[model samples]
Every structure is written in structure tokens, then in C-alpha cells.
Target chain A: MRIERADFPTSVTLDVRAGQPLALVGPNGAGKTTVLHAIAGHLPIMIGSIQLGDRELVELAPEARRIGVVFQDFLLFPHLTVADNVAYGLRMCGSGRKPARAATLPWLERFDLSDLAGRYPHELSGGQAQRVALARALAAEPEALLLDEPMAALDVEIRDEVRAQLADHLRDFAGPTVIVTHSAADVAALAADVVVLERGAVTQRGTWESLRAAPATPYVARLVERREE
Target chain B: MTPARRSGPAVIIWVIAALALALLVLPLLGILLSAPWPHLPALLVAPETLQALGLSLLTGVISTFCCLVLGIPLAVVLARSVGWAVVPRRLLRAAVTVPLVLPPVVGGLALLLLLGRNGILGKYLAQLGITLPFTTGAVVIAQTFVAMPFLVFAVEGALRGADRRVELAAASLGATPFQVFRTITVPLVAPGIAAGAVLCFARALGEFGATITFAGSYPGVTRTLPIASYLASQTDLNQSIALALVLLVVSVAVLLGLRDRWLPGVRG
Candidate 1:
């Protein structure tokens, strides 16, 4: 599917395929998140059409667009238990309290949160909260998932483990996925189809391996190299 | 245990703390110690005392209900506005804080001016066959006007400090704005709201100036415990002291009940 924003005061266009994970990588302030937000229906698109699985999604509200978002901060509800957090969408969708709660069990089991389902979000570790956040998004069964900097909030040592876990989760998820990241390690860890964004426009789009072959900018080169100084 | 030793600046700090604590506790101590030695238990069973206590509870609960319904939305509007959002929000914020700064007597006068039968807008309300001033309804209005600011301040502080990114996440999950507020925002800020409600309820329970001025002291109608105490002081000093002792007991009970909920590491 193609997404374009003509009146963003900037010409922006993005192309994503079904069952593909597109990673947006760029320097700080490059508008990578902006594009992701536009697709997720958080940002207003002056002139654009967003399609998800042959359906126009631009007209939908952020919640109604059938897209899951995992924020950088995890954004788990502090007052809610892990099970309730996962069940939030189901509950909101008018599922009764009993069934809504019961529906989250399998998701909790998949995330290894079954034992800790009763614990509040504040009681979970950072990695654990992030996983719960992912499970929460997936429990709703959205048409697409938008993950923004999944590993950024993680500490150095836990990064690899979380990244691996997130990769595995994304692999089994049956929807187009778009991940925004500032770190090249995240790009590699996700092994996403590269969509290099620069100041609200897509500079390049291709497979990660192909982008590594010929990076247009030094920023892109560093993205493939995973270097920070 | 021996009192902690202090020297110089530390001594001064301790003295200040002690003085502040004493200022708070002395009145309570005095009320307890100065109560009439005879017929105190009889006063508890008195019908007039029960009526005032019941009226106070009723008015306090009603006023607090009004505060919650009104204050939370105002807090949200004030907290979320930008530069253009500033002017109107500032005016509203200033207006809410007015009842807090203005003496309750002046607040009562203001309410009388706006809501009394001869008051502005009262003429139109009268045409609608509704008269507000000097009724039990007026007592609730007066108490709510004075108490809602406390709820607004508490809820506003909590809303400002809340991580709104969670709201954005909620939005992305297909929740309507209202749904997100009900399901997520309300639950997270519930502690602050609870604190604000406690403050409003306590203030309303003791409200006198606005209630007496606007609603007028009518036994079993507008007469709450505070107003009852004030009126009782006019003729019987010991009876007023008895009333004061009763107020102190009620406050202590409320504090004890709510303390664990508000305080960390304390079980409710």
C-alpha cells in the first residue's frame, strides 16, 4: 500500500507491502516519527491517503484505524494490572469484563507474563513493561502495528534480550509492521525493510541488505554500520 | 526515647517545627480539655445535635459531588491549553481561586448578589419560578463554590504531572477520547481526585460563612455543625464548646480513616 502527504507543507510518500516490517531510520529531528504518526493517524495529513489492506485508513481515528502503537515510553497504564493492560482494547471494544479479562490470558502466556498478570504496570521491570505493552497492542489484533523505538528505553545490557524478544514477536504477528528507530542496532535487530526518512520525506526505501550495499547519505551508512561516537 | 538533640540552625528548625505543630495541635487539645464535665454524653443523644450532624454530612456529600462534576473538566481544559488557550484559562483559573482567597463571608455576599431572589439573574430565575437563596439548595451551592477550587487545584496538578503519552497510546488502541479518559485518565488520577474530594468534603462539612450568609441558619435545613457551633456560642458558651469538641472528634475520625489511603506504606 502507498501513503502520501502532499499538504504536510512537504512532499512525503511511503510505500509498504503486506506482511512486511518497514523500519524508519534517520537522524534526530528527521521526521521519522512524524511519518509513522501520520500513518498511525495521530498526525493530521493535509493531503494524503493511507491504505491498510485495500482499505483507506486516513479518514479513521487513531484508535479506529486498526493500528497498534508501542510508544517509546511503553505507556502502560500504571493503575492497571498486566492482564488489564492487555485487555484494555478488548474492554473498550465492548467485551464484557469477564471475557475481556479471559481473552488476555493466552497473550500473557505468550509474553511469559502469566505469573505476573495480577501485578500493576509500575511493579514490572522496564523490559517486562515493554513486553506487556507489545502484548497489549497485539491482543487487539490490529491490521498493522507501529512500534516506535522499542529498544531505546531499555538499558544497555537488557537491549539484546528485549530486541530478540521483540523480533520474535514481530515475526509471528500477521500484519504490516513499521518500526521507528534512531539506533542502527535496532534496524539490524529488527531486520526490517529500510525506509530512510529525512525531514518528513522518504529518502530511500529498500531491503536492509540492499540499503547497506549503497547508502545515499552518511547517515544511512552509519545506520547500516550501527555506530555512535 | 530521648528527644533528638539539636544545635544552632538545627535547633532553630526544630523550634519552628515544634511551634507549627503546637499551633496545629493546641486548639484540639484545648477543645478536648475545656469540654463541660457534666451531661456530655447526653448531648450526643440530643435530637438537635443529631440533626445538625446529619445535615452537615448530607450537605458535605452533595457539595463534594458538585465539585467533582465541575472541577475535573475545568482542570483538563486549563492543563491542556496552549498560548491562545492561556487567556481564557488564566481568567478561569483566577476565578476559581477567588473563593479560596476571598473570605467566606465575601463569597457568601457574592453568591447572594448573583443568586439571591433580589440578585442579578435571580430576576430571570424567579420568572422561571425558581428561587435559590436561603434554602438547603443554597447551602450546597455556597459550600460547593467555596470547596470546588481545592478539587480543581489537586486534579489539575495531577493531570499536569500525568504521562499523557499513555493517553496517546490509548487513542491508538481504538478508544474514543471520552473512553480513554474514563478508563485510563480517571483511574490514574483517582488518588489525587480522592485527596481533593476529602479536602472538599471536610471544608464543606465545616462551611459557615457562605452557608449562613446565603442559605441563612435554619434548624434542620441550613444549620450544619459549624453554623450550629457558631449559633450556640451566642447564648451558651459551654454548649458551643461541646459542639467544638464534637467537630474535633469528627475531623479526627475522618483523618484516621483517610490517612492510610493517602499515606504510603500504610494499609487502609
Candidate 2:
């Protein structure tokens, strides 16, 4: 997948290859999530094109883009049970309720969320909700996956465990994955390639170790120091 | 018990509050006290009273249905017009709210000017052999015109308060825009729609001015319960009071029953 936007002063160009997850790390207002939203076809780019394979994604509506987005808050459908939420995409794609439920069983087992199928989002813990969000996103078999601060909503006590589980899920999905985050720990655990975005532009791009060795911006240096700590 | 300890301002505030409460409660007390208790059952079952009650219910239901069919989409459009230019959005809002504040009689007159037999649109409609004024259809139209704003406002508030990100999430999950509206947006605001429908129905049930001006009350055809009460007052004072008591009871019952269940934010 390739994205190029040149309309604004802070133009951004990004490329992600299949089976290789990339982390876009930036401070708040650096437009990390905006990039994710643009890729997912939620926001319009004034002068750019987003291409997934040979298809032009910029001209397509969000649903037709076939991208999975795990929002910062997880955003589990509060009115639906865990099972229905996971099966929503299948149902939307024209699967009957029984068939969708049947298809969702493997995802439930894979995510270890079988026991929570009947429960609603409000009844789940932070970690449980994250797993359900991931399960829901991946169940539709999207061509690309975007996660916005996947571990941001979890408590400090469970962040490590959930992060490990999330890393496993991200690795298992064979697609171009982009994780937008501000945390150095997420970079260390989840992504192999790092793109440091500041003020809506990419400041540095490299492996975590290489970026640590030669930090290009003050934000990158601070991030490297924090990771060392 | 602690009257002596109360400050002067506190005592004055309490007295003023009590007076305000009495101002609202006194009229309801008057209605109940003046009701003819022994003849109340017979008065309620009277043919004219039943006909008026039945007409009121039918028109109220039909008008509320019309409000829902028309008003929900209007509310959704108004709520989602956040990115629109300020002037147009404001104009749209003002148009929706005009009927809410406009005198019901004036609203009826406006409808008449648009749909009456000799009026602009009505003249064309008459050419096609369709006349609206002084008909049961006119009562439904008048009630709908007056009460639709209540539903629009309620549903608009609900739509605005709902998380747009959830809809975005649904979109990213491969649900089309219309699918998201049906499966997510509507369910998220279902309670608000229910409350709005109830308010609209109650407003329609109590509709008098517009119906009288536009539909011109006729026994068993256009005369509703409120109109029946007003007409009965000139002939039999006791029957009028009984009809009013019935209206009061029904309205109070509906509002009270739904308030705690649907509108937790609305409290004394």
C-alpha cells in the first residue's frame, strides 16, 4: 500500500508492504491517526492517492476499501453482544445470522473470547475489550489493518500482557498493517519498522535500533531515551 | 421544626418556591375538585364523548406516525449538517423550530394558505378533485405540523450525542452507509426516538387550536377530545369538566409512565 498527500504544507508519503507491519509514532496533533483515517477512506486527501494493490482506495467509500481499523477506544458496539459484534462484518457482507455465528466461532476460540461471547462491551475488562476489538477487525479478513493506539486504553497493570497478545495477533495477520501510536514500548514490542512523524510529516524512518543510534529529531531522541529507561 | 433557626432569606426563598408550586398545582386541583363525581362514569361513556375520544386517538396516532416518518430523517439531516455553512444550518433549524413557537392557530392558517380550497397549492389540488381544509386529513396535517418539532428536536439531540466514531467504526468494518444507519445509528438513538414519539403523540392528543382553525371541529369526524371539552363547556359544565379531567389523567399517566423509563435525565 502507498499513500501520498501533498496538498498541505506537511505533506506525507508512506509505503507499507504485505506481511510487514509498520509503526507510525508521533505526538498528539502530528496527524498519525489522520493518516490512518485517510488510508481507511474516512478522510479525504486534497491532493493525493491511496493505492492498495492495483486499486485506487482514495476514490472508494470506506466500506468498499476493505480495511480494518481498531480505534483508540476499541469502540465495541455497546448494544451488541461479543458474538454479534464479532460477526457484524460477516452479516454486513450478506451472511445469514446462523452462518455468521458459525463462522465467528473460530475467531472467538483463536482470541480466547469464547466465554465472553454472550457478554456486552460494558461488561468486559480493558484487556478483554481489546481482544474483542481485534477479533472483530480481523474476522472480516481485511486487506490491510490499521490500529490507532491499540494499547492506549488499557491499564498499566495489564498493558504488558495485552501488548504481547496484540503483537501475536498482528504477526499472525498476513497483511500490510499500520499501528499509529505514541508509546515507545509499543514500538519495541509490536513493530519492526518505525516511522517517526512530527507535525504531519515523517521526520525519520528506520529500524528501532538504527533510529535510536542516530535520532533525527528532538522527539525521536526523547522517545529513544524513554525506551532505554 | 427548625423554623427559628432559618435565616430570613431562606424563609423567603421557601415561601416563593411554595407559591410557584401552588401556581402549577392549583389548576389541576380545580379540575379535579369541580368534576361531577356521581355522573362522571355516565358522562365519559356518552356517545359524543366516545366519538371525540376515538377521533382524538386515531388522529393522534396517525399524526405521530407522520411525524416519525418525516421528522426522523429531518432530524438526522439537521444533526449531520455540522459541516454545512453556518447560515444555511441556522436557517434550516429556524424553519423546523418555527412551528414549535408559532401560535397553533397561525400554523393552521399557514396550512390553510397552502392547502385550503381556494389557496395556491389547494387550487391546483382542487383541480385534481382533492380538498384538504375542514377534513379529517386536515386535523392530522395540523397536528403533525405542530407536534413534529418535538420529535425532531428530541431525535436531533440524540443523534448529536451519539458517538460518530462508532459509525465510522461500522463503516470501516465493511458496513455501507445505509447499513450503518439502519444497524447502528438508529439503535443508538432508539430511546430518544421513543421519547420523541410519545411527546409528539401527547401534543397531537391535546391539539385544539390548529385543528379547530384548519379542520373546523365536526362531531364524530374532526372534533377531538379537547374540542369536545370546549364545546361541552357551553352546554353542560359538568360534562366539560369530566372530559377535561379525562384528558388530564391520560396525559399525566403517559408522561409519568414513560418519564422514569426513557428520560432519566428529566427529573424534578
Candidate 3:
């Protein structure tokens, strides 16, 4: 969908069909997260609009947008057990207890966190917490998914494991997913059309092949150079 | 463990700690020791004492609930910026702390001026047949007014520490702000909220000056434990001591028990 934000040029757009994974790559402080926040309705967008399929999201609140966001830090509720954390969005749906909790099991299994359901966020390893967070976000069954700096909190050791898990999860996701990250490896892993952000503006919008072959802005050039570096 | 190994400074510290402990513990010890040993069972059996105790518990719970209902949202507001402007935020914060720092009696007078039957706002409210002063409702209000800031201040501090990014994550997850508060924000800050509630509950339980001055001392109505204790102090030292002891024991026990659940990092 076309998610145009304030001060952003109207011609510059990134459109995605359902189930298409869009990996947003940019330099630090390049407003990658801000664009994702705009799409998710976390930040105010003044001039332009955001749409998911036929529904205009610019007028809606964040919840009404039904956009699932997995943050960089995972942001799992420290007070809740892993099961309850995964069951969070379901509970928000205002369902009965048995069904709501039962609905969480499939997601926990999808994340392979069935064994760690009783654990708190602080109790899990970074990778485990990340999966739980993903599972938690997905339980809502939103029209779109946004991940800001996914896998950034992981140590160098577990990043691969978490990325593979995330990749598998993203592959089966049925919604338009936007992942905001500065990491080239994660961008490649998701196999998404690249959206390069620079100072709250979209500098380059294309698949990795197009963007890498002929980089548009200095930001994309640095990204491509960093890939070589 | 050895006397000879203890240096002069160490001895001084030990003496000071012991003296401080004695100063704190003596009156409480004396209360129990000097209690009517022969009539202890009878005193416990006294119907008025039991009623006062029960009333204290009920009023404390009710007032604390009232405080929570009105205070938590106020705390969240105080903690977070509503708009970019700083002046309004400062005003709101100062307003919350006004009831906190004001002498409880003066606070009672202020509430009277605003809420008493003859007072400006109170007169308008009276036309609607609502009189707050010297009523059970007034008791709850006065206690809530004096005690609410404890909860508000505490929960605000908790809210300040709340990771906005986590809230953003929840918002991104399609949680409305209310849902975010219910599921994420409140649960994330549950311990702080709990601590605040407990502090408010204890303060409400022991609320004396404002409650008495505003609500008046009416038996089984406006007369809470502290008021009961105060009135009893005029005629019956034993009953006063008993009530005071109950408040003392309950406050300490509740605070200590709640510490584990709400204040996790507190060391002995």
C-alpha cells in the first residue's frame, strides 16, 4: 500500500501486495523506524496517507490499523509469562479464556516456544524472547506487520538462529510485512524489496537487485559499500 | 562476634544502631507490655473495638479503591507530556502535590471550602442534594484526597520509567491506548502501581487530621480508626493504645509483606 508521510515526496512510494515482505534498509537515524511508525499509526503523518489494501489507515488509530509490530528489543512484557505474553493480543480481542489461551498454543509452537511458555521475558535468552515477541505480535492476525530493527538485540552468536526463525515465520505470514533495519544481512534474509530511508524520506525504493545494481542516493551507496565492507 | 575485636568506631555504630532500634521499638514494646494483661482477652472480645477494627478495614479498602480509580490516570498524565508545552505539565504536577505537602488539617479546610455544604462548589453540589462533609462519602473523599498523592506520585515515577518504545511496540501491534494501558502499560508497571496502592491504603488507614476535620467524628460513619483512636485517647487510654497498636501492626505488616511483591530490589 502507498504510505505517504509528511514532507515526503508524493512520487516516491513503496507499494506491497499482501504477504510480500518489504525489508527497509537505511543508515542509523535515517528515519526507517519513523516510516514504519507512520504506517502503523504510531506517529502523525500530516500531508499524505497510508492504506492497507482497500482500507485507509491514515485516519485510524494504531489499534484500529491492526498492524503487528515486533520491536528491536522484543519489548515483551516483563510481568507476563511467555504464554500470557503470547496470549496478550488474543485477550485484547476480548475472547473467552479457554479459546484465547488455546489460540496462543499454535503461535507458541510456530515460534518453537512451547517449552518456555511458563517463563517470563527476563528469564528467556534474547532469541527465545524475540520469538515469543513475534508470536505475541502475530496472535492479533493483523493486516500488516512492522518490525523495527529486528534481531538487533541478539548477540553475534544467536543472530543467525533468530534470523532463520524470523525468516521462516515471515515466509508464512499472510499480511503485508515491513521490516525496518539497517542490517544488510537481515534484509537479504527476508528477501524483501528494499526501501531505503534517509532523513525521514524514502531515498531508494526497489528490489535488492535493482537498488544494489544501481544505487539511487548516497545512503544506498553507503549501504552497498557497507555490504562490500 | 568477638568483643575484643570490636573497635571504638564499630562500638559507637553498634551503640547508635541499638539506641535507634530501642527508640523505635520501646513504645511499641511498652504498648504490648503495658497492655491490660489480665483483661487482654476481654479487650479483644470488646464489641466496640471489634467494630472500629472492622470499620477501619472497610473504610481503608474503600478509600484506597477510590484513590486508585481517580489517581492512576492522573499519575500517567503527570508522568507523560500531554503536549509540547511545559507550563501546563508543571501546573498539573504542582496541583497533584498540593494535597500531598499541605498540612492534612489545612487540606481538610481547603476541601471544606470547596466541598462543604456552605462552600462555593459545595453549595452548588448541595442544590443537587449532595452533601459531602461529615458523611461516609466525605470520609472516602477526605482520605482519598490526603492519601491519593502517594499513589499518584509513586505510579507517576513508575510511568516515567516505563519504556515508551514498548508502548510504541504495543501501539504498532494495533493496541488502542486504553488496551495498551490495560495489557502492557499497567501490567508493566503493576508492581509500582501495587506499591503505590499499598502506600495509599496505609495512609488512608491511618488518615487522621483531614478525615476528622472534614468528615467529622461520627461512630460507624465518619469515625475511621484514626478518628476512633483520637477520640478514645481523651477518655480511654487503653482503647486508644489498642487502636493505635492495631494501626501500627497492620501498617508495618502490610508494608513488609507487600515489599516482596511490589518492591523487589529492597534489601533487608
The TM-score leader among the candidates is 2
TM-score of chain A of each: 0.94, 0.98, 0.93
Query: Which residue segments of model 2 deviate by more than 4 Å?
Result: B1-13, B263-268
In candidate 2, how many clashes are counted? 0
Q: Which regions of candidate 3 are displaced past 4 Å?
A: A8-12, A215-222, A225-229, B1-44, B82-84, B124-130, B263-268
For every model shown, the clashing-pair count is: 1, 0, 1
TM-score of each candidate? 0.90, 0.94, 0.86
Candidate 1: segments with Cα more than 4 A from true spot: A6-11, A199-201, A227-229, B1-25, B82-85, B123-129, B256-268
Tens-place lDDT digits, model 3, residues B1-268: 5777768678899999999999998988888886666766676657777777787788889989988889888888877766648888778878898887899999888889999999989999999999999988888888888899999988888888878677776666656789888777776677788988899988888888888888898888878778887888899888877777777888888788666555432111
What TM-score does chain B of candidate 3 reach? 0.86
Note the residue pairs that clash in candidate 2.
Answer: none
Cα TM-score of candidate 3: 0.86
Clashing pairs in 3: A63-B174
- Which model scores highest in lDDT? 2
lDDT of 2 by residue, A148-167 (tens): 99988999999998999889
Local lDDT at A159 for model 3: 87
Q: What TM-score results for chain B in every one of the models?
A: 0.91, 0.91, 0.86
For candidate 2, the per-residue lDDT at B88 reads 98
